[model samples]
Target: MQQLQILSGSWEQFAQDAKLIREQVFIQEQQIAAEDEWDSEDAVSLHFIAYDQGQAIATARLLENNSIGRVAVLKEYRGQGVGRVLMQSIIQLAQQQGRSFVKLSSQVHALPFYASLGFIAEGEEYLDCGIPHMDMRLCF
Candidate 1:
């Protein structure tokens, strides 16, 4: 068995693992600047890490206002359900916290994927950190 694990906690606790995945997917691979990739929000957000066979393969974060962001899955793991699992975990956590909605700014190319997960696109597409993105929301 691959023994996939989905762990959630403070950024401080899993910074190492989360950083590895995020830096690879966002910073290095996607050309996002290092400073833009690491932000102060991490200190306040809840982080989720997906590990496959003990190797970190995906990560995401949910903020206090139910804003979900920083979702990144290593290239090799895309389309394998890792991103879906991470989003579902975040949604379940928000519902457990009595939140009525969850929002995220998704990269333009990823809009369909988020939409498939029930998130609706709102407002016009705009640039964020040099990447075209759109604001999306899901209501519980």
Candidate 2:
């Protein structure tokens, strides 16, 4: 595996790289519709992209509301701790910004992953883009 580097910036700075990762993970692998995956929030949200040897492999975004979303890791990179590191960076950024907490809509299957990071499940599972998800929050 190549050395992993995560870069955070505006949509314009990271859009191309972020979209490529999201397209592979969410659009092709998960079969999520393009319409459902892309959103207006992207333009205003802070984006994080994980790159390996300069190739984008994972992505996530932190919205102005202190909500995290659009987390995606390529199939080849799953279970490699890339996602965890990416999320940790986002959480730290939230703390640096003086946020009380950060919330996310975690896919049901990934609940344990987020839980291991200190996120607590908040409500009953619901379908988002046809996938089971539940709200989770991590307080600083």
Candidate 3:
């Protein structure tokens, strides 16, 4: 079973694993600019980390406006429902906050992935961190 825990009990684990995952996927794999990945908005963001077999395998962040971003699951754990757990948590948080919509910038290739989670594309595609992306919103 996967454990959905807030960024509390495992602060170090969260920071390390999240940094590692983001560093790999966003920074290295995707080549997102270093400064682009670290934003001032992180100060008030709510972060969720999922653990499987006692390891932090997935994570995502919820900004104050209910925007979901920086979602990632470890390479070895991809396609195993880890991203599903991360998105599931984000959706629940949006509902709890009485937020009407959840917005996210999805890499062009991952558009269908977000679509599967009920996020519809909005406007034309754009580029961020040198990668093609599109804005997606999910209404609650």
Candidate 4:
């Protein structure tokens, strides 16, 4: 419930905070393998971080091809609009860049949440790092 500040920057700039959030949410909580959690794309992706009480509580990234990924929020902060805020920030950034569409592979459990933001689910569900997910897209 602390004041939330959302920031957009290069992965290099927010690497420590971003990685900490992802490590806690995806690796520690979700049991995702450390090897799968870290990736080479961070060097090139546009990153966003949500800070509450000066702590990085959530993080997401936008790829050059208009795909959003690595959306992670700390466990205690889930269901508090942090994820929506992060997604909206990415969507706004996409709009600013004149992107025609944005896409993501959303975990099945979070499908409804993404749907509420106007992202339509597509294709059959598949596993990503042992988690069921489906491709979702929102077209401008």
TM-score of each: 0.96, 0.97, 0.87, 0.97
Writing each residue's lDDT as its tens digit, candidate 1 over 1-140 gives 26568899998888998899888899888899998888899999999998898888999999987899999999999988889888988899889989999999999999999999999999999999889999999999
Model 2 misplacement above 4 A:
none
- CA shift at 35, candidate 1, in angstroms? 1.1
Worst 10 residues of 2 by lDDT: 1-10
User: Relative to the unseen true structure, what is the C-alpha lDDT of residue 107 in candidate 4, on a scale of 0 to 100?
Assistant: 98
In model 2, residue pairs whose N, Cα or C atoms come closer than 3 Å (at least 3 residues apart or on different chains), thus clashing, are none
- Global Cα RMSD, each model: 1.2, 0.8, 2.5, 0.9
- Give candidate 3 misplaced runs (Cα > 4 Å): 1-13
lDDT ranking, high to low: 2, 4, 1, 3
Q: Write the per-residue lDDT of candidate 2 for residues 1-140, one digit (tens) a residue.
A: 66789899999999999899889989998899999999999999999999889888999999999999999999989989999999999999999999999999999999999999999999799999899999999999
The alpha-carbon lDDT assigned to residue 93 of candidate 2 equals 90
Candidate 4 wrongly placed segments (more than 4 Å):
none
Residue-wise C-alpha lDDT for candidate 3, range 68-95, written one tens digit per residue: 8888887888887778867877798779
For candidate 2, the lDDT comes to 0.94
In terms of TM-score, which candidate is stronger, 3 or 4? 4
Top candidate on lDDT is 2
Q: After superposition, how far is residue 106 of candidate 4 from its true place, in Å?
A: 0.5
User: In model 4, where is the ten-residue run with the lowest total lDDT?
Assistant: 1-10
